[model samples]
Target chain A: MSEKVLMKGNEALAEAAIRCGCTHFFGYPITPQTELSEYMAKQMPKRGGLYLQAESEIAAINMVLGAASAGVRVMTSSSSPGISLKCEGISYLIGSDLPCVIVNMQRGGPGLGGIQPAQSDYFQATRALGHGDGHAIVLAPATVQEVVNTTTLAFDLADIYRTPVMILGDGALGQMMEPIDFAEVPRRQCPAKDWACTGTGMKRPHNIVNSLYIQPEDLERLVEERFERYAKIEAEEALWEEQNTEDTELVLVAYGITARIAKSAMNMAREKGLKVGLVRPITLWPFPKKPLDKLSATAKRFLCVELSMGQMVEDVRLVVNGRAPVDFFGRTGGMLMTPAELLAQIEERMGK
Target chain B: MSADLSFLHSPRITLITGHYGTGKTNVAVNLALALRLSLSPIALADLDIVNPYFRSADARQALESAGVEVILPAYANTNVDVPSLPARVASVFDRPDLHAVLDVGGDDAGATALGQYASRLEECGYRMLAVINARRPEIARPEDAVAMLRAIEQASHLKVTGLINNTHLCEETTPQTVESSFQYADQCARLSGVPLVLTTAEERIAAQLQRPDLLPIRLYTKNYLERF
Candidate 1:
């Protein structure tokens, strides 16, 4: 048995990145995520890693791109608006097929919404992180322990697929404290970065890391090849957790912090003799459609809960495909919905 | 199985400070609520500018309803993350009749907020207690804990007169966990030349410990689902 220590979600994620051999961290401070950057600043140098606070979020993400291009494990983190500033760099990372980890401790909204927890960036993370037909592997962990596990996995997935990976968290998840043991975190073997633009040393052909292709045919060919990789990830990398789904009438679908709330509500509904269950998607980008697709065959309906105004509900609706009616309940601007409120929503949704 | 809370009586002003996420805010809130029974005109000032969430101000409704005046940072409970202190924090010091419980932030960064009021606090005669959780990595060892205490002292320009052992793995805490932390807290107290005044445990775990020094408390700064 290993010693378990209490740590905030952001601190745990930062420490997990260090343990998993993330050698460089570039970030700008934001609410709910400043602790991550602050931790990196204090500990990275001690652990023989580099931590840089760039002039802006745009500069920080570009620094991540520069570091990732050199074949090092690199990461950058931000909140919602700060993440929006990194979109151009994210697109460049995808265009060049660079591997790096990006953590978004999401706060509310379309613009400078609030410094409270929110899942409003669901569409931004899943559909339009950057302007392209590219996708990043987005993992939304519901607990601090899972935050550590997924952060390590995010780096591995990035290196393995040579595509960016996103750890989607909310303010509540980032700020809360939980007990976790680092010794229990799994370590993945990453392949060598042969494509990295490390100095050739006159040994072989010089490698180049660039997103710009002058010829449209060359760019299209590259994008098509990237789509194949995305297809494989969608098939093999989607992860989800199902609880009490057997013969259940109503299945609640949620990710990130809302999933934790939904789980409690699910148990409450069951105590009241309602056939309620929960499907928590740990992977938001791949969307975890298989389990939902299978459940739609038996479940009467789906309820999507979030800290946003109906973002992930769209994904649930798409997965259910009218096999069952999809419903949504959300609280915006950093307000958290209580389990009792969710229970009431469940009772009303079931027409009880 | 009730805790002996007499140790908290004479501080006049009690400022809780410790490493980040070591249950400082929880302890401050619980202490304020507990003291309100015997003490009059209780006030809790949220001096945590380092953290943007889960501050003592978040429990304003509960604290205010219990008749504990809650003084928060200027931008607390709002969308802004500015590290502004409330002008009313001076009132906690000026009014000699008020029993003030200041919830300082985590680490030296968080303690900087307390420095500006060092002279006023000294005039009012305060006892700052550093909460220690052996499970937290930065201050797990006695030497490290003392070093953090010294750093906080330097940052806040005030001496920590006492230590509180608050070791736990959140809800996973067991009596054994609290028992095992005794030596660490004792050593920290000895090394820093400060008295080990109290050890806090959850109400259930505290009953099992059956220790006189134990202060039984219900964790208030938990997630909504944890309480539900």
Candidate 2:
């Protein structure tokens, strides 16, 4: 049996990153996500790793870029607002094809929104994390244990694709606690950082890490190549979990903390003989379109529940594509929809 | 209830304070619930102004439904980040019959909020207990634990009457871990001149130890938001 330990979601992420051999963490203090930085501040120094409380979120992310350029596993964490500040740096990392992890312990958004669990950054995280053509591999974990497992995978995915991978969590997942077994997490084989900008020492040509191109043709070609890589990632890495979808009339689509609440609603709807199921997207960027499309073949309808104002519902709608009706139920501005409220919505929609 | 917790005699007011991540709120919740086993008119006051997570006020519904009056700040369970102490905190002293348990904030900065009620707490002859988790990085050493206790005392303006050894590594905690922390706890107790009033372990570990001073408690810090 694996060693089981109870830990807060944020703290667990820090520990998992350490176990995954991440030696550098740079972040600024922000609500809900502060514990992640706090845990790093306490543990990183003890482990002889670099933990810097950067001047700002922008500085922290740039620091991550520098560390990643040096051929070492590195990460940076922030909340929604802080992530917004790090947008340019994120795009730079993407353009340079640097491997690093970024954690967004999401809080309420749209210019200094309150400190509460929110998924308002869905559009920002999945569709447009930064300006210009860029897409990060976004992994949304539903539990603390998943946070641990996915964090390790996020590092591997980042390295595998030479791109920044995001662990998009919210205040609830950051604050919540759960028992996790980290004993047997299989490490993936990543390509060596042969292109890293370590000192040349006259043995090899100097490697440059930059996101700038003087020629439009060169930039266009680079963009096309990056999209090709993204296409492969989309085809291979899209992940989701299905519950009771094998025989169900309605499939509930949600992610992160909302998925946990939706699970309770699904169970209640099942007890009421309502044939309800849930398809929780683990990788939000890939959007789990294949599984949802599969469920659309048999399910009568789909309901996308989220902490935002129906951001992910757009993805569900695109995938379902008139084969089945897609509806959205969401609560924004840091308001959480209760299980009872969700079940009532499910019944009302199904009854109609 | 375990035999070890029998020594708990309800005082007019009990204050629980400790370093951050030391399981003070957990201890406060367990103590309030255990005291409710015999004491009447129990009130658990959430005085935490430091940490946004794991505040006693978040468990208001459960505690109140169980007939314990819960006193919280104006923004106790809300997403508001302001640290405004409620006027109802003074009401706990008004009701002398109420066995009030104050779950203060973590560390000296958090404990500083308790300074406003220092005179009231002192006059009421309260028993302030410093919950110690040797696993916490800030107070992992005996000297660090002593320094934290003194800082909490200086900030709260209330002396710690006893030490509640609550050392554990969360879900990874084992009986051996609890047993090993005894020395650290003893060092803190001896240096601070505070009695080791209680030692807490999870129910399973507590059952294995059978120590007279151990208080077996169910974990309550996690899932605090799910209850709401």
Candidate 3:
């Protein structure tokens, strides 16, 4: 048996990326996620990979774009504000049909919000990360081990879809310590990068990696094709976990660190004779609507808890679509909601 | 619940140092809380500037209520991620009567903050304890553990006088996990020439280990998903 090693979520994510053939890392330092860059800085050279600290987040993401266009597994990470700086490059990567991984250890904010953990970037990650009809595969893992698993799978998914993949972590998940086994990482077969911009030695035609389509009809055709891929991803890649939802009336919906807290709250409600369950979305972009759609028929109510002022609740409400009443309970501006506090929300929603 | 803390002997100042994610804050918090039972006016100075979360500031309410004075950075647990140190951290050196427990940051990056107080710590006579958790991949080997210990010493300009085996897999720790780490810790002590002072575990797991110097401690730091 492979020995389990304890690691912080950020460092574990970095190591997982390296283990899964991420040969290049371009990053800038930001709180709650700097350790990922720090780990890459220390270990990348030893593994014969490149780790460059770019001048800024913009420089780092464009560096990622450059590396990914050459058919190498590359990644960059940042906190909430830094991710905002990388959006234009991310859109370029999407428009050029490049594959890479971008990690956002989310902090509270519209602008320079607190460094403590917050999931306020749900809209940023799942909705308008880049200014176009484009969506990165946003994965939200609650535990450090899950952070590893998702990071390892992220590169593969990006390659499979030829799109940028975002590992949406929070400050708490980035800083917390947990045991993870690197030997247990699952590897998927990625499709060949035949359209890479690698120089041809007069053997094949030159490949052009550009996002600038001047003609409106040409841009529309490419975007429509990308949407077809997005449709396939939404149909096949929506991931979620259901706890006690088999016969529960009150179901709590959360993602990232908030989901972990809601799990504890659901257990406390269960012990007090209230039927409570939890729906945790592991993939935030795909949004895991199928299970919620199925549970909306039986569950009486759904409470969306987050570290933001009800961002993910909008998605939950839209998914439930009045099949059941969806309620919002949250704490914003870097404040964390404890299980006891969430239990009170559950009990109040259950009219107890 | 106390597992005979007689084997533990902290000087006027005890600085805890180790790699990141190796439970430095956990050990420092547990030691300060346990020592407060008999020692008077114990203060836990959070000198970690590297990590933003899971610092001693997170356990300030518990330690303060237990009569342990908690001194941390002003920006700790706040929205800002500034790496500035507080002026009150010097109170540990000013008050000679106070038994201060210093929780240094993880690895050499965090230890740079502790280097600022090296002169005062040397004059006052301090014992720096390096924590080792064998389950951590970076320091799983004895040589890597010793190298990390030496790196912490180089960064902080203070020598590690003792070693504490605080190895565990968080909530998944078992007697076998604690037992298996014994050789790793012992080898680290032998290589670094530092005495292996104490092996910490929960009271239940402490009862199972056959060691003379075991300090059974309750965990004060919590993972959000642990309750599940």
Candidate 4:
């Protein structure tokens, strides 16, 4: 009952969202990520999903908050600026303890950035999605199949953790189409809706979903409780794929689109007698520090490859604890580095 | 009922059908878009209940913006495990401004749903075009092609309006095969009253065909906002 179908990463996400019970979507037009929104626009209507072409990123994020508070597996997506606007809502959802999916099909930006895919949002998504003392369950899928798999998992994690889950993808992943199995998707066992604020009626007391805790004591209590949930989520959702990391002298740490290319380059270096392997972090937030730290102890050197000016490399350095000499490779503003370029980097580092 | 001389009827509703490698859906999508210059409000519904990969509706945004109403089963409507046809499509029957193009699954038991919609299609006035790709397995001969069309018309309750020559080998297709397809289409036209309304060639390959009188074709993949 399953077969291979070639699809763009964005297309696979839409299909996966449908398969995984993502019936509500709100997004604005952003290049490199336009396909995803376009997919939703055409397919959502037919599928009976709520697809709103939000007036602005602010409106879009609020729409997501509205839907998420209703407990309808809601999601809103944008690139850099769009994601920045979404941060406040993300913090709100975290404070209010509402579950939802937030996809950052990352594009280059500090402000109104270029449409080219970039990983600059790593810290934005990983450290602080919005203004607050909070964390998000962020997943970075490297393949088209993983895009489907990770997004589906994001929905589950958001529900289970009652927090927002960020799917960190760049333009390269969004645009490239590859063969995938849209069928084997497991049915999502919806969590108890007792957490949702869908009007309690007279069933006990009137339910309320708000980030506004008027009392400082109540706000501190809510933040502390949410942090407890975040701790549990961090323990549970740290995901990374280790490709030949055990015996390798030099290990490359990467994620999302860049990670796939890194793996290919590492394998090429492996063939060329350079002992380089790839460690891909599937969840950027839980950041896979323990495993990376362990690898750091054994590995003679570490390399971090990224689309930005080596942002994740900083995380790698922090996790490495100076156990190994860390190196960095990068291309910014949507320029993709080929396997050849990465292989050269690995070879150069090995020569060092 | 009256002389509905709209673009949809000018190039009748023909279906491109076959197995996975048969190039039917590809031909169907290309053909529908190629005929777009004349503003054909083609209804390309992927009844590919067999294989959900590369569905016609994936390109719905392009067609819809071009004023072509695309039909696909409501995915978000219900939690139903299997995809069922939308009830509103029955209105395509009464509306002359519409054209109904169905891309059904392969010849196996997957195509049985066609019988249910066939009669309604007849009353609504649709011209079903059976597609043949010589390179497709089990559907090479004219007889085999006719049988596939017959099976679809029986299942879908639509008449074979004509034949479409969609002889392509994906991105590797050449102008020669498309030209030979044109000849095969003439043979099909001789037997069936439905005219061989068109043949498709990649814009590059269409340039290679170099025939001034060739029917319309879909050679380019248009982005969504470019629908007009």
Which is the leading candidate under lDDT? 1
Q: Determine the iRMS, in angstroms, of model 4.
A: 14.8
The models' CA-based lDDT, in order, is: 0.90, 0.87, 0.90, 0.71
**Which residue pairs come into collision in candidate 3?**
none
Interface CA RMSD of each prediction in angstroms: 2.9, 5.2, 1.8, 14.8
Lowest summed lDDT across 10 adjacent residues in model 4 chain A is found at A1-10
State which candidate, 2 or 4, has the greater DockQ: 2
Q: Using DockQ as the measure, name the better of candidate 1 and candidate 3.
A: 3
Off by over 4 Å in 4: A187-190, B1-228
TM-score, ranked from best to worst:
1, 3, 2, 4
Evaluated on chain A only, model 3 obtains a TM-score of 0.99
Task: Report residue A281 deviation for candidate 1 (angstroms).
Answer: 1.1
Give the per-residue lDDT digits (tens) of candidate 3, residues B51-109: 88788887888999999999989888788878999899888888878998899989988
Interface RMSD of 3: 1.8
Fnat value of model 2: 0.20
For residue A74, what is the lDDT in candidate 4? 84
Error of 3 at A140 (Å): 1.0
Winner on TM-score between 2 and 3 is 3
Instruction: For candidate 1, give the lDDT of residue B131.
Output: 96
Which ranges in model 2 have alpha carbons more than 4 Å from their true place?
B2-11, B19-23, B33-42, B61-69, B87-99, B107-109, B115-124, B132-159, B163-196, B199-228
